[model samples]
Target chain A: MLNNSITAAMADIATAVKRYSLVGMLGWQDVRQRYRRSAVGPFWLTISMGVMIGTIGLVFGQIFNSPMKEFLPFLAAGMILWSFISTCVLEGCSSLIAAESIIKQLPIPLFVHILRTIWRNTLILAHNIVIFPLVLLAVQKPLGLEALWSIPGFALLVLNLAWISLILSLLCARYRDLPQIIASVLQIAFYLTPIMWLPSLLPGRAGTYLLDLNPIYHLLQIVRAPLLGQDVSTVSWCVAGGMALFGWCIAIIIYGLYKRRIAYWL
Target chain B: MACIEFNNACVDFPIYNASARSLKKRLIQVATGGKISSNEQGRVIVRALEDLTFSLNDGDRVGLLGHNGAGKSTLLRLLSGVYAPSAGTASISGEVASLIDISLGIDPEASGRENIFMRGILLGMTKSDIAEKLEEIIEFSELGDFIDMPVRTYSSGMHLRLAFAVSTTIRPEILIMDEWLSVGDEGFKHKAEARMNELVEATSILVIASHSRDLVLHTCNRVIWLEHGKIKMDSDPETVTRAYFGH
Candidate 1:
């Protein structure tokens, strides 16, 4: 039954987390290794964010004819969220391939590898978060403990990301080329998902419905809205919660059916 | 020292064709095979272990002598809990250190120092335990300055040294090895043999899957000769080895 599969998957996840602390370390190492031997380390992420927000704000502000003051903060917030979401989806697609050696050698929980991918990206996300506060302080924008709400908002984003990572890792493992396909699709998704510009600026009636229907768009809204001190919509909450549950269900079923075959597949 | 049991253990591997791994291809093969000839399934399911039952008690140094593809590695995997049996139980009472593949989990990109930690942890060594034996492991491996260099840069000999050092350091109650003794060079082999002897003396039970008759006689008092996934002979090393080799 569907209920039984969910229960089995939950049990597998718990077992995996307990058995593989190294998986978390592996994820952390990936992030460290990426920027290691470089002069600035993960500050590269922060630097990249600064460049993006500044360039996009200056260029797009004039094009959209929006005020510079309003546009810069909006662009900064949008860029930060886009970076978080894009990293989760992109790195997640390769989570399994990168951990192939570990998977073959030891039968630790597969989900641990997925968690490693998400956690590592979250670390980079932390470095990027530093830019938001510094920019706010420079502008003399009001920043308060209420900004802490973004913590829970970010946590939800992670939970959803973990679910996606699990499903994608399993899929790509079975089909060697799926990771590349997912990468190309993610590029397309960036333009579609309201990352670079506001969905409000889009021409129109049906486009709003498409944006509203996207769980990713809602996920970004949930976290981005709270971080930017905008009102959180009930619709966004329902969509995010719904996607979280649904994504987990799908991840679990795929993992349960395919977990045993993974060793052979490798 | 504890009891190890594999009760009615069975392992079924779902075999796929070499060309492509897809449902459509498999279906086409099945459909065509049925029309062309016999065994219409077109796919094969291999039973690596079938209703195998055995138990080993404390202080039993058992050698598994079998031809290649005779399910020796599969049996060791079941013992190590790497592959769970499909039909039955593989139960062990105490901590087991499996040298099934001596270099199984070493990260190639990591340095010798980092691999020492990774291998140590995979062998179930605690952080402090690894710390306690760090100097000794590095010294025995003779990897002096190479210890800090990445493993990808190490020669095969150096890689084997690091793997052998980490695995042999941990003395488990039950040790399972699958042709892992032959890791390093001639000089290192002597050192490895001595370490294996020490582990054999210290451990309560040791299961070795090897084709070497000399190794079987020297390391194990008991030997089990397996053929076609069944135990053909199980007795004293002298008796089983003679029967296995038919000499």
Candidate 2:
């Protein structure tokens, strides 16, 4: 019985993944529709992100007594990645529920909605990523081979985020307060994950064990370190990789048990 | 071969409150009564469908007849595989398309041509399939000049024309509809009806729910009468409709 459920859930995921055109088009339309009437359109995402990163970078650089050259690039990578991560998590929570019209009226795999959530946010990330390069140029950081590593790092980060978001979407669908609870949790996570402050600032054990313990720290490190031209610890890679595998297993099990119930839950 | 086999299929709808959803009224409010009871965990459960055992095959055109809360739509959703039965099983073979809302994925901000693709994708058509039918869908809607314009700019009749054209453009193995779809102004409605008929005729199996007695008697070979989620009667359309409408 358990095996059958898992296989069925896997089938759902597989079908959703194969329908990339639908997911991609729907996601693209989501981004387009939201910014349709605006003059600059989705560039607004780029603009706001630039403004937020700039103000935060200068303010925090002054407070931490860090040099602007290194600090701005660091802040850019961290903030841009954080935007993608947080949007996916927040929107993914409501992905299935927001699709109530389609859910009830048509027969579709539930994961497709979540994929749309991730895909649209990824497009927004594409807009926001423009700043990372400009910040690096401003810092005069020579583009190096390590910077290309962020490609794979971003892929892994997306994989990890997908699993957690999938789990959270199911929970949020069943428990109405879960989205609110998760939003608050992410707000705290945004502060604690070292996007604004340097992980090295914690000093000694705080930097060593505490940063290691937070999976977000490792996830941020793998991609952010690559973009900032810093060496990502082997430990960060392993932790992020392990978290994806482990979280997906749990997500798959929960999905198998509750996937069918989602239509009813909404 | 298109086939659907159901063995004692049952559906239980748990009506949750502020814990699972906000206190806003439900969007799927059908006229249900008496079956709203609590379970062991004290969750209010509505028995939407109970112990339904039936089978449908190719060439079947079954009409669902019921009052507002008699579970007709629920049965259509169950048949379309949207809501899995809470117990037992319904194994349906062949592709199923549910026309519960034909314009389900249509974006008002998008051009009518783009909405064809959007609604087509939502209907489970491949991108290539939608592209291939793009011209046909636009021509059928008679919206030559407006096809490139956003759907929001279209008149109400034109909107329905676009929706109806895109939705019926695909002929699935099994077709599920909430009602006999007839749209557009008087003149265009004839063409729309003809298109709807052609699509319905091409399907191997069809299940449509309706309150119209004449539409059922004229279109369906068999009729199932539902009352409070239970099958009260199932027989030939003539027998069932006569009994249902008290004619």
Candidate 3:
């Protein structure tokens, strides 16, 4: 039975990966449905995110006693990545639950729902990230080779979020209160991960260690530091990469055990 | 060729109520190792299907007749590959189209045209396939210009027409339906029935679960009567339906 389940789980994942076109189209429809009937469409999300970053950058820059030139770009990159990360966690919790009708009715792979969630959030992240380049230009940040580092950094971030979303989505589907717990945890995570604040402002070694202890902080640094024209730390890459490997190990094991039960759970 | 084989297949549903579905309670149960004695209060297990053994070869039109909660729908779902049996095994080969719930993925806020694609995808059709059948599906729905409008604006009958049109657009080797489909006005029902008959004739195997004895007798060659997850009777439609209705 154990061997059978493991094979079944792998087969399901393989099938879901093979049907990328279906996943992509469904993801596109999800974004389109949310923005239907709007004149500006998904650009409206970009506009609101831009406004939030601008206002928060100004007010928080003054409070932190930091220069607007540095603060604005940092805030923009951090907020955009944070929105992507947090939304993946918050919305990922309901990924399987929200697709209950399709899950119960269709014979498609369970991994399809996970991919659909990740892809949908990725599209919305694409819309929200438009503000990053504009913010960088506004701050007069120079284009450098280091900015290209963010390409790999962002890809790694997506890979990690995919596993995280799959794990959380399954857990949340089985346990009804998991979404609420995830939401509350993300609320604390936003403050803890230093999106609105600077890690450099922390007084000493303990503060530095605190940032190191946070996996979210590591994920943020890999992408945010490079996009802000700062040096991407080797340590952040190591931590984030390690977490991805470890997270997938746990996610797949849990999936192998619980995937067949998901339909019944729903 | 299409075939479905179930060898003593069983499905047990773990009924997780509010307390059972809570992580905190489960965590506490683990931490205390059940010493607190609240672990068993809400864990209810329902055996939806038990030791169900059956097989179907190509060109078999099997009908399932049973009272409510007799595992007919669960059995259909098992054959459709939606639910993996908890025990024993099920082997099914062939493309399957399940009209268990015609509106399974219909979005009320989406336009009928968009819904055709959405429902088509959910029903296992590719985008280009849906595109190829788009005109036919819309024309069959008979909603005309209303196809461009949101489905929420449609009346229930119109909604059923749209769902039925998209659902029947695909031809599968194995077709499974939970109940008899009867929709739309008298004129439209005739049209829908004709379409259903054409699709059913094209499939290699058909498994329909219904309570209608007359309907099953008319359409199916074989019948299986279920009682509380076990096969109560299995025979030809005439014998099974007669036995089912006490004729």
Candidates' interface RMSDs, in order? 3.2, 2.7, 1.6
* Candidate 2 lDDT over residue span A1-266, tens digit each: 88988998999999999989889998999999999988999999899999999999989999999988888988998999998898899999999889999899887888899899999999999999999888877878777888889889989998998898899889888777778878999999998888999877888877765597888899988898977778989999999999999999999999998888888998
TM-score for each predicted model, relative to the true structure = 0.83, 0.96, 0.94
Candidate 2 docks at the CAPRI level of medium
**Candidate 1 off by > 4 Å:** A1-11, A35-59, A130-142, B1-3, B17-20, B23-47, B86-94, B104-111, B142-146, B149-156, B180-191
Q: Which one is best on DockQ?
A: 3
Write the residue-wise lDDT of candidate 1 on A90-197 in tens digits: 778778777776665554566777877777877888888888877776566766566666677777888898888888877766666677777888788777787666
Candidate 3, clashing residue pairs?
none
Model 2 residue A249 distance off true place after TM-score fit, in angstroms? 1.0
Off by over 4 Å in 2: B19-39
All candidates: DockQ = 0.28, 0.54, 0.65
Sort by lDDT, top down from the best? 2, 3, 1
Sliding window of 10 residues with minimal summed lDDT for model 1 chain A: A101-110
Tell me how far the alpha carbon of residue B136 in candidate 2 is from the true structure, in angstroms, after superposition: 1.2
lDDT of 3 by residue, B1-247 (tens): 8899999999999887788678898889888877655556547778988998889999899999999999998898898998989999999999988898898778888899989988888777888999999999999999999999999999999999999999998899999998778899999999999999999999999999988888898899999999999999989999998889999
